[model samples]
Target: MFAKTTTSLFTLALAALSAQAIITPTSPDSNTVVKVGEKINALWTVDSTDNWNDVEIQLMTGDNLQMVPLATVATGIDGTKVASYSFDAPDVSPYSKIYFLQFTNGGATTNVTWTTRFTIAGADGSTTEPENSTVYSGQTVQWGTGTLLSSVTTDGSSNSTSSSNSTSDATSGGASASTASTSVSMSDSASSSDSSTSATSESSTSASASGSRTAAGASAASASASSSNSNSGAGQVTVGLGMVGVASLVGLIMAL
Candidate 1:
């Protein structure tokens, strides 16, 4: 009977030691707050002989510390079993004030590495409140202070609690595409305006050249008209002299 009890005690002590020889989370401390969709280095120290093939990563969030499965990562024994995993913080609406990490082997009875309690929040430290919450006079609202109005309206009310799950996984790829298209359109418009300006400049040059030629032609035409008028005046004087000589000869013949 004594031998049996001693054997049982030894077995229990061995199990305790085995359980104690597990992973140790060593990156973010208890007071650290993580942002949604932010990549964090999950550093840990592991036993060299332990199996790392089926290590499960989980996040315990919310006030109740609800378990949410994260991912399964691989750990290998390369001289020092110090493992570092990159983890992207999840988006949970109404930030998780009480959150921690749990890393364990995939087994019914296995040792675990429970990290310190941290916070999971939006990138801006923003949280969502229940839509049916009641606010009295001078009560702060959602991260902002609001002044109470003179009148308060209470039409319908209910006593219930609800939970919402949100994710920040969607990226801004569509916005980037829209910006690229806008840039291309602006470039095209600029090119079109440059072409129009060039055409206008060419038209202005052509008009200036045409105006200069018209001015030169007008000057030449005025000079030619003046010369022709002076020649007509000289011919009229020569004809008048010949008519006078003929009248004088007729008078002399009459006197004879």
Candidate 2:
């Protein structure tokens, strides 16, 4: 009986070591936080298997969002028994997401996943003014702020939470574009001011010169008319005097 009990204990210990399919990840650490627009390259190293003929590479992303399925990658067998895989970041993406690597060959399999959390965000792109990062009026913005732009694991098997899951509820904008336009207007303002002043000065100078010429012409015409009138009055007075003198002489001759 003692021999049988000893045998059972040895078998249990072997099972515990064989069931250890999960190992350390070569990629992002579990619970790691990443910014938006990051390329999540999930990699794994597995325990060698008896069947290398049917090795498979698989990745899964889990959150409250359903319909997103597992992905498959095809890498040929290698003598090293270690495999590497990569995926490029998309043009637009959720605020955050979860990713892990897996290896399978028939009954034999290996799993490597993060133990903590991971995150991606726009804040990684640049720092914002105190007034422009977000517009919620004092609401705290978590790393995984909402469901629309984030994801979480399911089945109650783990404690995973992303943003509220309302990707539409989130909105973002940048002052860079608006600031560029404003800069253009500011540069042109100096030219506009100079042009306005030059136009006003030119108009005033032209009006002053025209008034001076009109006043000078009126004075010349008035002087010429007065001189002609004075000459005619003098000639008329001389003619009248000659006539009176001649009549007086004729009367004296007749009396003699």
Candidate 3:
């Protein structure tokens, strides 16, 4: 009787061990939103044991025995070493729907695990309406309101590119304005210099002509008066030229 009891106890223990799941899905939780034709990774943690040697990853809907397979993600994956699989989401007609992933062991006894429900959006950003059902099935899946994939990822990059282009254009415009301003200033300086030189030349010529006239008029009267007039005229010309030089120097300083 004791041997029979021991055998029954061992059988129960084996059944309990077989009932335990070997794969625990960690990604695509209830809040996940994926788009059709987009690549996604199925990640999970392995409860390493001799119960399973290989796994089959599948996209599924429904709950428990009513679970429906939507797509096969991978097959015959080494369960002990591989913890993640990458695959593109298949294009399903009426692509907007809520779904989950199922991991099934390929061992002698099937051990299954499932991820939480997630939304799959269509190319137009449409999604399945949120329902009150907590269990994920084909028609009755629960999701949050407005749980659609955002366009920010693609729009943000385009906005960044536009901003960079605008900045570059502004910089180029500023450089051109500076160049034009410098050219105008140089031209003004040149014109001022030309005017100063012309004024000095005119003043010297007028003074020389006045001196000659005064010397000639005084010579008819007295030699001493002629010499005094000539000296006075020369001093006036020197003072006028000095004033022009000072004015030009001031203008250069102001321009700088």
Most accurate candidate by lDDT: 3
What does candidate 1's lDDT look like per residue over 1-256, in tens digits?
9999999999999887765566667866655777776755567776665545456555543222234433332323231354766556655545644556667666323576667556666788774442222244665222211211122111111111111111121235556777889999999999999999999998999898888888888888888888878888888999999999999999999999
How would you order the candidates by lDDT, starting with the best? Answer: 3, 1, 2
lDDT tens per residue, model 3, 1-256: 9999999999999988756747778997876777776766788876567344578777776544466666566667776777787666555544444577788876233466789777777866677664435553555555332222322222224466899999999999999999999999999999999999999999999999999999898776787777889999999999999999999999999999
Model 2 alpha-carbon drift over 4 Å, by segment: 1-190
lDDT of each: 0.58, 0.48, 0.70
lDDT of candidate 2 over 1-256, digit per residue (tens) = 9999999999998777666544334665555444444555555555563324354444444432222324443334341364444443322244443433355543243532332224434555532222212224575322222223333222121211234333223422235556766887886786788888888888888888888888888888888888888998999999999999999999999999
Backbone clashes in model 3, listed as residue pairs? none
Which should have the higher lDDT, number 1 or number 2?
Answer: 1
Better of 2 and 3 by lDDT: 3
Query: 80 in model 1: Cα distance from truth in Å?
Result: 7.2
Q: Which stretches of candidate 1 lie over 4 Å from their true place?
A: 1-16, 62-82, 107-109, 127-256
Clashing pairs in 1: none
lDDT of 2: 0.48
Segments in model 3 whose C-alpha atoms lie over 4 Å from true places? 1-15, 18-21, 63-65, 107-109, 130-256
